[model samples]
Target: MQKKSSIFTATHGVMTTEVGVISGELELRTTCNDAGILTLAITYVGAEEWYTLPGEDYRLHDPRDHEVVHRMLTNVLERT
Candidate 1:
């Protein structure tokens, strides 16, 4: 079994789970405006994985996911 340990920044408004076997981790971009201020909400979608109870680190058996995630995120960010 594999899991994630960190929230890797996919882009300005998107984020992805890092150090996990499961791939295709994408987050929707949401913005909130209040008092003329804006806040971005990165909502992650797709599969779900759990980490150790006492720790926040996760394991990824398939290291390929990490590379893919980075590539995908970069492409999306560049487009947007």
Candidate 2:
């Protein structure tokens, strides 16, 4: 469930199970499949801006990387 690829134009390729702290501006995009939906969030790490998401499983490639990227984006709306 982990893939290290630069499949994006501006991101290091959205991680499906990544996690990290926010410290800047970020762009996010979430989509849904046949069974469920997936959320993609990117933090600028400079503007401290990120997508509004919470309470879900996530993953990160590097152990030092704590940003949620390639993890399962579930129960996001529940944070409200």
What is the lDDT, from 0 to 100, of the residue 59 in candidate 1?
36
**79, model 1: CA deviation in Å?**
2.9
Best by TM-score: 2
Superposed model 1: Cα runs more than 4 Å off:
1-25, 46-80
C-alpha root-mean-square deviation, each candidate:
15.1, 12.7
Q: How does each model score on TM-score?
A: 0.24, 0.27
Model 1 vs. true fold: TM = 0.24
Per-residue lDDT tens digits of candidate 1, residues 1-80? 22222344343343234443222444333222222222222333543543212222333344545544444434654343
Candidate 2 lDDT tens digits, 20-54: 44322244444333333343445443445445445
lDDT against the true structure, each candidate = 0.35, 0.35
**Lowest-scoring 10 consecutive residues by lDDT in candidate 2?**
2-11
